[model samples]
Target: MTQLPPRFEISRQDIARVVAVFYERIRGHPGLGPVFAAHVDDWPSHEAKVTDFWANAILHERSYDGNPVEVHRRAGNVRPGMFDTWLALFDHVLAREVTPQQAQAWSALAHRIGRTVRAGVVDQAKGPGGVPILR
Candidate 1:
């Protein structure tokens, strides 16, 4: 029997490989490295979880069960400005790890998610009841 194609025209193994390389670079990145190292103790475990996350997102596997919004919001270190840096690095990883079409599709998805997570982080910093802080 022929296997069903993965979502967004990307393969599951490619996602896992990209995630691994992305995090490997993250661990050594000047800004992102310290941020992640502060929270992540086990690199292998984190990579696996993130791999599952990508699988769920791009493969529709439903294996990931974590809330990125809450996690980034509660981290206190996650900043809206940081998403730009994160997306840039991630885009670079995608370009190197996968085909151009796959990179384009997945990078678009990553940017969308980054915007969402960034909004969540910013919203959590509101003065009260989701209201923006004023001077």
Candidate 2:
């Protein structure tokens, strides 16, 4: 019989570390800085929410139940090109902070979530009189 990979939970400290590292990058990153600056007003609250979101996504512990897609959509206009920049930033952070396996797993999940959010937002944007859905 085939064996499954070990099930592990990401700790709160890990989530905080990841989000802090990621936000540090966002602060300096040319592509994402302005977007984040413009949309994110409460840095502390935003950081906490992001930490919870990543924890839930990676650990499947349901630490967060917020809709990221809806949040992103409602926050402001996200240019189509921003997704590429976001992915690149995530890859950089993953390389710096996580194990190879952890990085790979996180990247895969990020891609899936990005794709889903993009499709949903794009679809809503195209619908007549429909508001873009944010997380």
Candidate 3:
């Protein structure tokens, strides 16, 4: 009988690795670094949040519950084009470290998060003076 690969799993350690590499790239990204740097004071806390978020999103671990869209909106005017750049960076890191299926899942997750965040921001912006509720 032929052996097959085991079911894919998103471990906390694996998610940490991905988040680390992703942030490494994000830190160097010209478009996002300044914005991230200006706002995020605690790198470890931020990394932990991302790790939990991805683990929950991809692995159904339920390790994260905070509002992601609120987090993004707090960054202020995350121009539409930034999502593409963010996705590109995420894909690059994920591809370098994870399986194809894992990468695909992450890509889809990122798009969903981006859309959710964007929609929340846009909806909040529609209020009286075109400003988001959180920031």
C-alpha local distance difference test of each model: 0.85, 0.76, 0.77
lDDT tens digits by residue: candidate 1, 25-117: 998899899999989999889988999998988887878999999998788787677888899999999999998988998998898888888
Task: lDDT for model 1, please.
Answer: 0.85
lDDT of 3 by residue, 1-135 (tens): 553332356677988998988888778878799888988799889999988887777666667989977876676756555777888888888888989988887788788878777776666555466654433
Q: What is the lDDT of residue 83 in candidate 2?
A: 79
TM-score of each: 0.88, 0.80, 0.80
TM-score quality measure for candidate 3: 0.80
The candidate that wins on lDDT is 1
Which candidate leads in TM-score? 1
Q: Give the per-residue lDDT of model 2 (tens digit) for 31-114.
A: 788888998889888888888887766665566878877877786677555777788888889888877877787888888888
| Pairs in steric clash, model 1 | none
Which residue runs of candidate 3 sit more than 4 Å off their true CA positions? 1-8, 124-135
Off by over 4 Å in 2: 1-9, 127-135
Q: Candidate 2: lDDT over CA atoms?
A: 0.76
